[model samples]
Target chain A: MNKNFIILGGGQAAVYAAREIRKNDKESNIKILSEENFLPYERPPLSKDFLLNKKNQEDLFFHSSDVLKNENIDFENISINKVDFENKKLFTKNDDFYSYDSLLISTGSENKKLSLDNNLNDDIYYLRNLEEAKTIKEKVSNKNKITIIGGGFIGLEIASSLSQLQKKVTVIEIGSQLMGRIIPKQIADLVQKTHIQYGNEIILNKQINKIIKKNGIYEILLNDNSLIETDFLIAGIGSAPSVKLFEHTNLKLDNGIVTNEFCETSIKDVYAAGDVSNFYHPLYERTIRLESYQHAQNHGICAGKNIAGVKTEYTSIPWMWSDQFNLNLQLTGICDDYDEIIERGNDINNGVIYFFLKNKNIRGACGLGIAGKVGRDIRITSKLTEKNIIVDKQILADQNQKLNKLIQK
Target chain B: MSEENWIEVGSTDSIEEEDLIRFDHQDKTFCVYRLTDGFYATDGICTHEAVHLEDGLVMDDEIECPMHQGIFNIKSGEALSPPACEDLKTYPVKVDNDKIFIKID
Candidate 1:
């Protein structure tokens, strides 16, 4: 019944939704408003491939610009300034008003630029999109000393990538551990060790006090009274949801735009997906705002199917991965709020396995590699965690027993 | 190079613990998977990105990409989950006793 479907933000969510909508309803006009000039591209490669020079600009794009023409989808490189819910339309920065029968708010998150007390703040860079990655790539060349702020996924990924290019990397984290919010502390410590093993300095439990430029270099003072000099600074402190357009609108907002299981926002005839959605996940039985490729793709498909009159619910399990050098760190389900943490392998090197147990069941797991078998184990136990199946704690902690056999009911 | 389309990758013992082994024939790479049930073969690289499937981990008949956790069905070379969209090219597996062979076009 909805003919004109307008999607805001031109990331993975918008692209996937456009594809799904086109597959179901051919006659509906699909328009995507993207702030970036480039086509929808893969964000993961920005810190990995784009930095390593393994992937070029063409490789970054998910589809060619002609894809819009071929797929009969309307894509415009324009920023959406405001949403007019009263008129069922949205206003662009160019003063263009777009009316839609149905709207999808896929506007992803933006990099939270650190508000530092220094005039040399302009010298620091943050990698969120292709443009910023390109800028960092240009700046990183022939530059030896690099000070990275924050120890999150983005910060760490960029750290490992820059260190691969043989730059003296120093990662400064305010937290005592890396990836503290997601993985367990033991795993975070192992990651820090791995970085140190790779000849990168990791200074934790401290942050920048202030910064200034001295003789074409950045001299950063830390809260611990220590000093660091670097060619430049790259801060991946964190990200905030791109919900600025919803200030005047009646759309419910929290960490992000709130959505139901069907990826439908509180507002009727409007939906939300991707990183910008704080969706009520069926598995977790709570509202979650996930920033991952899997959720974006699945949520987009679910929202598109719902928009096309299909009653599809997004129920995919949340999983995340990080590649540091030869190590593969993978986690399935949430690790927080577990009653006990069962650890196997050496927590220092060759990886360790942390089975987050609650109620005598493996609710989730994190695998770090000194050996490369944790990912497979996570896959075996992920179903158990999702289904809330009770597992023998001893069997789970035992490395000799096959996880696949233990999981068999 | 061998008799007909079947080319011996090595013995069945060569693949240890469900590790995906990459075998090359002509100009294409095929990932030979050893599962608890049986042997399977598919395109070596991930359908999502240009990454070797052998670099990923294999559980049962599913291969998870190392770059992203995109899974692929080893028996049919079907892209089972996201980040992955296109189905991989599946090749027939013919295990001759201890020696295993893959049939690729």
Candidate 2:
């Protein structure tokens, strides 16, 4: 039977879902409702190569016009203004209503802006899409001093971009360490140290009080009564899931739209993927929300296969990576509740691999500045973690023992 | 470039059963595999990222990437799984008695 598939928000997850659906049921009508004018593209390079002038705008795009046309997928520049899940009908921003046999929501997330008193500021930028990244990159060339508020992954990434341009960059963090929530303190300190070593002024545990623009320059006041004057301001504070469309529908919403192991939402014939899904992962044995490139891609594939009658469950261990300066931080699984940490390298920058354990078994593992042969072992730590067994602490800590030997028993 | 397109990597005896070995030429890296069907070669780095396939585990006819667990067919160099959408670059391998040669294009 032929089906009509409608995917909301054109991003990695949306594109993957459409591609997966096309791969299985070629007769299905696939329509992608994208808020952006361009088709689904890669978002990772916004802060790295694209912002630093290494890659052009066209290079960041994942699918070309030829590919989309060949796949028989239609890409529309529109947003979901309203949804009628009972009849499986959704209205676009242009008031165009359409019904679907299967609906996949991949609205992703929106950036959080500063709550300052500056009513209308022209120089402030928040990078949530390729267009914003392009605007910031163009503004970077004419500005000498840049101030970035919020020191999370997005903030640190933009700092790296400004650093590449040799701009006087200052990062203000409300937390004591950078990326504290995502990683352990030691790892966060390592990332902070790398940025500092590159000659950027990093201020921690400080909050932005207000923003006052005078004489074409922005004056940002800190909570401690200190003032910072910069030519422009960029906000990378954080992001929240875009779940307004699903809120009216009766779909369960926790931190995001709730989904089961198969990426199916509370309602039937409806699914959600990417950053907008707060899914119950069988691997973690808990309901976790992940915002990453790999998770979205994997979820789309899994959901697509199941929609095609394969019945695949997403039980893969969660993983994320961050590139700061010369440091490559790759982490697997969740370590927030671990009781013990076993580290091999003395310093984080030189190269260190830390394994977190709760009951002598692996809970999670992270490696900083470790690559090549040594990195291959650390990369598979998540696999051992998923085994749900225990390896000797001595063997896991010992750098001499091969990774295969440690997992054999 | 190398004076010869085909460079001798090592002895065929060094290629063990069900093992992935890495060798670098110029600035590029390639993985040499010895499976049940015999020897095959592919680009060293995972198409999803830069992790080397030689560091990954080989099972049956498929090799799993260490970074994300994405699998690839050793014989065809086709990315058989998600997280890796692009097919790996493969090279023709020749065995002259004890010497193993890879034709680098």
Candidate 3:
């Protein structure tokens, strides 16, 4: 008997899992239900290259129109709001039901929106999908004074993109630094300096009191007793797991949907992946849910392989990168609770790396450089962290030492 | 068939074993790799994005892109991972008198 596999959400995780399932089990019936109209597309480029018009819509899709059809995968543009664990079925908003042998929940994450007392104006924007990105692009095409709320990755990336378009952009963050605690203060300061150097204003340690809309302009009132007016407003505060549909269900939910290392949820025949699943990590011995491109794809593959009876564990290192202006930042592994720190390459022109160490083992590593300088070392750092290798501080500090040599040890 | 078509990249000693060098001939860029077996060549830029392949780490037989960690086999130019589905174009290489030459039209 052929198994019926149903994947909810049509993002990176959903699409990758479908492909992997097809690769391992050729006879199974794979169906992908996406909320968005378009096929699965790369979300990383939406704020960077896609905003700059370097990449078109066609270039962002995971596969062509007929590619999924050729693979015998059925894709439907429908939204599922409820799941029946007892009957192994899903119910859409229209009350349509579909039974499945196995199901994967890769609903991904949703951007947190800023609620204001007076949002009479519809000029504010939040980017989560291609449609929202396109809307923001169209709205900001003729606007110059742009104000972005939140100093996270999305906020900073959008600021970088609009700043390159020669717009006057102001970033408002309630926190003390640009990125949150994941990035060290020193590195965050460096990133903040780069943004200022590129002519983008960074306002930190201030909260939004209220927003008053006037004739074709927005007056932003900050708790610091200051006001700034802008032609356009955007918010990238942060995101949370899109687990609204699974609430009040039998499946366990922590920060996200709780799962084992094999991506199996509390219930049998039900699995979760991507940002929605806070699965246990065998390496770190804790549960974590990542919202990066690499994790989504790899986790989905792991889920698919396990569902196909391959029993593969999800053990890939946590890796993600952000591009702002000409500087590229790459982070790998857990970046907290470190007892020692090692610095390598002080100059950002060549590259600068910070290794977070606990008991001499590499807990995490972060690097900032001119685009091409940091990737190789960051990759090596992930490998060292995965293998539980204790690295020497002197060798890590010295730029002359090759990191690959440490891997060979 | 023509002598002018084969472009000399560099001496075989220039690249270490299991490493690659970026060779820009005319306007086209190519990644010339020296693996344990022999020398091979492929398009310098990653098929998924515009990142240079020389910055990528070279495993035994695979080259992982520095940008997104997408990997490609240096020998056959086959894309081995997601985010990079399209295969890279492989070029034929030959060595003569310790000088590595890639046959390009």
TM-score of each: 0.89, 0.90, 0.97
- Among all candidates shown, the one with the greatest lDDT: 3
Model 1 clash pairs are A350-A370, A351-A370
- Where does candidate 3 chain B have its weakest 10-residue lDDT segment? B46-55
Q: Write the per-residue lDDT of candidate 2 for residues A22-99, one digit (tens) a residue.
A: 888879899999989987877777887788787788877777878989999899887679998898899867778988
List ranges where model 3 is wrong by over 4 Å.
A118-121
Judged by DockQ, which candidate is best? 3
For candidate 1, what is the DockQ-based docking class? acceptable
Instruction: Give the CA lDDT, 0 to 100, for residue A116 in model 2.
Output: 70
Q: What is the C-alpha local distance difference test score of each model?
A: 0.83, 0.81, 0.90
Local accuracy of candidate 3 as per-residue lDDT tens digits, A1-409: 9999999989888888998999999999999998899999999989998899998998899887688998898989998888899999999888999899999999999987677764443567998789999999999999999999999989999999999999999999999998985788878888999999999999999999988888988999999789999999999988999999889899899988999999999999999999999999999899988899999999999999988888988899999999999988999998886899999999888789999998889989998988768888899999999999887788889988878767752
The native-contact fractions of the candidates, in order shown, are 0.07, 0.21, 0.57
Across A162-181, the per-residue lDDT of candidate 1 in tens digits comes to 99999999999999789877
Ranking by lDDT: 3, 1, 2
Error of 2 at A156 (Å): 0.7
